[model samples]
Target: MEFKYSDNDQLSVSSTREKIQEEVFNAKCRVLTEIRECGQLCDVQIRVGEESFPTHRVILSASSPYFRAMFTNSQFVDPNQQVIQLEQVSADTIRSIIRYAYTQQCDISTENVESLLVAADYFNIVGLLSECCQFLASQLSAENCIGIEKFASWYACSELEQIAHNFFMENFVEIYRTSEEFLHLEPENLCRVIASDDLNVKSEEIAFDAIIHWVDFDPIGRTCYMAKLLGCLRLGLFSTYFFVEKVKEHRYVKDNTACRPLIIETLKFLCDLDRYADARSLGNFDISSCMLTPRMPHGILFVFGGWNVNSPTNIIETYDIRSDSWMSCQTAESDYRAYHGTCVLDGLIYIIGGFDGMEYFNSVICFDPVKQIWLEVAPMYSKRCYVSAVILGGHIYAMGGSDGHTRQSTAERYDKNRNQWSFIQPMHQQRSDASATILDGNIYICGGFDGVTILNSAEFYTPEIDQWTLITPMLTPRSGIRVLTYKNTIYAIGGFNGVIRLNTIERYNEKSKAWEPGPEMSTARSNFAIEILDDTIYAMGGFNGHSTISSVEYFDIDNEQWYGAADLNVRRSALSACVLKGLPNAKSYVPSRSRVPIMDASDTVHLKDT
Candidate 1:
């Protein structure tokens, strides 16, 4: 026998289920209110200091494992006992904990969270303890992170400890300089923080200063561990000027007998860079742990130039992938320009021509993150808007774009030695709003609009031959698209195909000499910025035909799925982005573009200017 239902029966059944849920919710609210107001059915009295709380044993037992064990275990205290004395917890904390037991809600504030956490931990109230930890974790900053980390570590709250630890590492320099908590860190904790390679301080000079300050805080008590702490600082990262002028003559360094040999060895290593290898082998210290490296593997992604809702914006922001946070860069007044072409060379970012709402630009600017300065570079041969630029063979190649009047087939290259731009062999077809990337020593440029129509045509410039060679066209004609090289394959991401905004993506495999369909993006975006970090391609901020979007998403190569990342601070379109490696002040070097075996397409097509 089978049961069947009509449309009316199904509706009636759904209505009944919703009604039952509402009634159950109402009953729960009534029971919680009665427990708070009447307290007539409370079977147990919890005494803390001079105050006593009336609560039911069943609610307490259900809310906490410690209470459950105390009430249920025959070998422990009897469940029939009328009152239980809690000597460790305070009266206010006990009341808050009991109130949470009955209502599953309690106020957690800066003043009360610590005491509540202690009582919650003692009673094995995991939920309440978690709430307290989360509240404290959110309140973490440069000033309070050290204390929170220590507290979380002592209480065995691993999640909270990690959160506080990350904050401390990210802001080590400022915290060491300003936080009173930093001066109070225990020797072991201080050593651990100093030893971490993830510290984001500008130089080892700050680390050395931090060590000195710690010792000076309690000289007699910390003097014995001076050598141990000094061993953890990356002294090699400090400049010779700092070592000779500041550190060498410090009373702490000169007075400490055990630390003298370490200082001498560091100076010797600095004098003869080759001696670093030998010193590492001879010294018992872990050399790798004391070496300075990038805090983030692929560095940070800089998002530059885009149109806000009302108009073009010169705002520049950097996204820290590790922290999943955005920070504004201290850019110069001239740095406010959008719709520009961007490429990273010699650890420097080059911003090329674009429209800034009022005037089109042919000017170029170079940003040296290490120096934290932006310098106006040699202007391009012709003013271009919607251009694409890429670095190949130590020279930056500016590809086709509109000069605000005509779509140009002309290309140019910049010579760093002369600090000038010179015209190069022009493309066969005039195009604008295209994208370019370098692979196998050749520059690949793909899909954009000619003066008449959108294009699917693709081509490459061979430096050896010094000529542009046309390649297989894309599956769909698109302009304002973003192309990225990853894992030896080229991905063309989302774009507008003249009629509609597209989320479609495609990839080019050189071995097959063909374009293959790839995964589509979550949003149909155009003129967005795209960057590849650690094999994942992030698509951020673009126009979806009707409006600019601040949303960002990434495609995981291994999983073959798209997931959302943090949104930008402002909605934007026609933005540019690139990854910069290492902290500022580290030695500058061009980052190698290596790839794992993965293919992804998350392009941004150009939407026709409204």
Candidate 2:
């Protein structure tokens, strides 16, 4: 290759010299390293603690702004000065850093990371500073994340500070439970964590407990911070029993004048929740009342592709338990199907076997929540609607459904890695509208119509033997029922009992080997989407024996009853719901929180009027 002079006499490049430039850079680094090691022509000595390192002035100046300013400006350095002293950085840290000035390489690890970050930033070594920050960011954990966040912020490492802060909030529960640094956080940092809408707590009780513990750690120094932190909790969420016995009666809360108003406001909200629920139902409620607003949940519940208003709908939505709201997600353009079954496995949401309108489909669609795109996975062996779907042993099992023409007893499992569906041992009965769940290492499916009869029989399949065993039948001949497994207990609820739509609930007693009656749901409905959120069972939109309804409610085991939740935007029946946990961008699926906790609860109230 050659270069030539242009008409204007400027040299023009004829070929790329990228490879040659890289070799030249490597040669310069090697020669510099050798010279520094030999101490031949070293112009400066860096003294830290009891050690002095011989270094080249030109090399340090070229590598860092801190050195460049000292060597160039008299205000920073004397021309006759031959040595520099740094009391903040240890000699061991400078040795590696100085070596990096010559070789452009340094060893960074957890042991030396904090020291390296401090020294690298102090010396204004951009490359080394970046490496240290990256290493620290990767090493973020619940045990040390609070320390990392504090240090990163103190050092003005903006990017690392933000990452560490987000990690602390996302893993808040674990950090609070395990991190010793959590108790030592300054009031402002502690306030920020609790006030964040993204704080993940199954119940507000955890937040309440955290503040008490934190304040009690240094009672004299921290008691004054109780008011500031107390406002950060969603106090209206706690029952009156817990509030009076645990919070309102706590010495820190009861004795503090500033916390008294918040305490009173929360009591008002608790007494009037039913009234507020009515107002919220009519769209007249203020969701901005911080005490009433829910914190952002880490897991989002998805309800997609359902039978709505006498027809199939492709509308997709997610239930944010924290906010008690349903928000729509992007839908597949032409893939409207209903009576389908869905499950989340390996981060992809699978919609298997369902009917569109006139035709039954054996197609499978996978939704990539991050990409917001729908992709096709392997289809099932049979076209199915009213299908039973469960994820077991990392495989998605599609069991009996109608397939439009007839009830199918055929079963198949799809392997996502192979992109293939293999036939599995079929169920004993040709059942449609049967609900299935993975319980105790087996696929237990129960209650469905078998063409001529509404079957009360339930059965479980063991993959190891590829066989089905009949369990004792339910006391009632129920079809279209939903079965859920939680804490090793199987709960069966709401369905047609061959005579009428029933909301009666029963749980399978594993020891008794029989279905024992449990508390009934608030609404009697059939063919609804049921899922567990916040450790409770929420049953969404379905038929109420007359027409389709949009009512939603959750059953609380401790209270032994169902409570109303936000209703669906549109009426739905034969819908499928799946719980998608630990979504990286969970906020994208849930409602955006505009306000934090009870600061507004106290501000908007006039307690004296009472």
Candidate 3:
């Protein structure tokens, strides 16, 4: 295929090559000029197949976007120094990024990530940098994150650093923990990383020490100690020793480590559960010291579980609206348990399964306030503790519960007439200490423990198919959280965050199928009780991080917020409550602990209805 070269052909080929080289040279000059003259730091260059952006341009522009943007118009350039390789990003992607840079509202497709990131970092566009950081965090991977690591470090992107910390924390054991590459990271950053499996505590300690020393050199104190602490707690590496060491030296924490009177007041308030008779001011209604209960009974308000002292009682008390007092109606027909579930149907108070210190009970028992007797019904197939139960469509649905050792996904239904237990489809996730409530023909379950971890995911039960369908997860992962339905929406309130109790509240929108952030409780807690009266959702006693609270408060669901309410008389959890369907008597309706049956004395006492 050899042919003699003609002078005209030779000149034409030479001219084409020179023209290509000239275009490359011009792109390089544009990037350098933007950086040196315009103060735009970007490494923009054209990338052609198998070609390298000139070495001079690579060195001069380095990681800046100015040099990278030159390739926006040229289809042919060097590949190695393109900033984003020609093979990876399409021409349209580059165009979109260029558009986004000039106009704030332009849509930048995901394919333009590299160019946008380079531009964001190089130009010092803080807003764009944060947005890119968030976007990158969402699509993070070991491969992609590795490439972006150097850029993140060069630009001092604290947000990206946190994002990396979270990603590593969740996937450390699976992807990065054993890798030599990640193992070489600074001790502090290493500590910030998370692993779902087991934490490398010793490695974390080493990193934490290094960070403390390095942070000492930081005068402005930009380092995030709280974020690091949360990371440690999430990874299950936090302990009394870690807390002592960190709290003693960290600058972020408040000086007062000792408990105050307010703390005690908070504990009292949470322990009150839903008995708000004694509440005078917001101060007494301490909002902090309790966890949210998965089981919250309507109308009953506070149903006192047996005391927590050495002599725990099997007594289950109910707060009656007509009486306005707390009284132990009768010992639970089943076992003496804390964290048991109680729900009221018709005139009977149903105390479902819970733990009795040694064992979890699936036994279902009902008590009649009028008959003054407890009757045992069919027991659930699986024994559960820290469980939640809800009545939907005239049937009782029992969700997740622990077997005193492991969480159970299995659920069951109780037929009122037949007095028997039947199995229902299990939930997607096994969770104990979760909350369930009826809303719009669906039972919404939120926040619970699955033996090893707290869950943020939620699901709904459709009575039509008798199946559980997954829904959007809550914003926070929690266990021992309580949920209530008011105004057709479900409110999730107060729960343990493993490290401490929380006061954060959120709700589920049936129409949207999403959880929206809601008002935070005055006191952080778990194992608390929430009830709705009129327009207000009352949050009663439960345990906070350090202790229990007698605090009570209410939230205006319609307003999407909360405010303090009257405190309860006693600090109690694991109580039962029911809306007082007041008898048609002439008078004498006061809130009390004992529930009076809606029937008259002449009504027959059927064992099934007890």
Candidate 4:
């Protein structure tokens, strides 16, 4: 079709703007090639340490503001000059800078990064300086973070300094133990590191040891700063035994006159746990602000296998209560198993019987968090699912669950000393999906289905007598309930009441032998995991009837309110969870000499058919 043109008509046009950009890029490439290969067009000579680099002054002037100022203003050198000498930077570094000016690219390695960064900053090359900062930031590690942070601060590289400082804080434990630079830290920097609540240490004992190590390395020189450094440690968090055996016994504490008052204050604080507020005022340091409280040790909550929306899963994840973050942990070496029972004893997590969709399992497994590995342990006597296991009197009591064919009232206890499971006196009632918690030296089992009906009956077992006695029943009959002991009171969290999912919560007072109403959960759920960290009860992912959920909420005992926390990465139900004391440190594990099948995040292990 032919178009007629009119004065009022407008038309849109498409143009190849990229072609013009390509032509400009080609011209720049040709100029760089000529300067590099022929050097005939070179108008400036940069002389450094017995070597010289010849390049066009126009390229250098455009790439760096320093060069531009020198050439345009003729401040120190004439634009017509053919050679300039730089004594501060080496020849190799000067050549690299010139190459970057001409080609807009340069290689930075560990050997040359420091020198190159210095030259870039000196020449006022913003792009090269940024590149060097980014490279150094990416290379920050426990071994090199101190040096990088110091260098970045000296050079006024604020972004690089902050990055290096954060890495140093997060990995301070390893750096303190292994890095030579830690001993050489300036007094101010050393105090700042020790004072930080974000330092991931297993305990204040580790931090104290680190301070002592630093002082002992150069005792005479560091003795002057002993009071200042020791003041930063959270001495109140240490036990009385540690203070007596480690702190008071140390030479530094005895020799330093300035440290006596601080030690006395710590002793007073330990004697009276309620003296933190008063001590803080007197000492000018807030003992209450310490990350590890006097009551609860630093720990991570490990959540094990559960059923996802579509199927069961053997995935594991950990929650760092201090950081309030969840990280994927090593998975288990078996088919997806939910309704499993778990308890921590002697630094090992023992996983007991549970269902795996098609069959009830009596199999038991042990997980070493440090080694990040799982090992098979002695299996239980009966095929059980939906069991409740608790560590009482140094033995694992695996109680009431279905055996695929029948609900079990049978029970067994595994003695770690004997490394075997032995039959224990059975409960009065058969129960599955029940909850068990230890209180006042007795194991209390409460609220579960008996394969016939949901029961409200609760019982406590005396290990010495090998007998179970009925206790006060709950207000409501529940299955899949979670029982936890806090402040000597038993809390029954959300669960199913056979008719509907429940948000109702109740507490049992062992001394009074009574059940009292408690604050309800935000959502009604069953088959979830509950853990008490620092007096707050966290209820994580579970089935709400129609679908599995990833939502998590914590019940603050002080405020008597429920608030949301971070959600799980996967929606699941019937998971097992427990809090293991100590900071999460993968390097703490001693490597096993014997070959054992280990399961990691990237790999899965299948159980051998027996």
- Which candidate ranks first by TM-score, i.e. highest? 2
Pitting candidate 1 against candidate 3, the one with the higher TM-score is 1
* Model 3 lDDT, residue 298, Cα: 24
Off by over 4 Å in 4: 1-297, 330-335, 583-610
| lDDT agreement of model 3 with the native | 0.57
Q: Write the per-residue lDDT of candidate 1 for residues 121-196, one digit (tens) a residue.
A: 8999999999999999889888899889889989999999988987888777779888999888889988888877
In order, what lDDT does every prediction score?
A: 0.79, 0.82, 0.57, 0.79
**lDDT of candidate 4 over 296-344, digit per residue (tens):** 2245677888888767887788765533456665333334789889999
Top candidate (lDDT): 2
Error of 4 at 168 (Å): 21
Which model, 1 or 2, shows the larger lDDT? 2
Ranking by TM-score: 2, 4, 1, 3
TM-score of 2: 0.68
What TM-score do all the candidates reach, one by one? 0.50, 0.68, 0.45, 0.51
Two-way lDDT contest, 2 vs 4, winner: 2
- Clashes counted in candidate 1 amount to 5
Evaluate residue 593 in candidate 1 and report its C-alpha lDDT on the 0 to 100 scale.
14
RMSD for each of the candidates:
21.6, 10.5, 25.4, 21.3
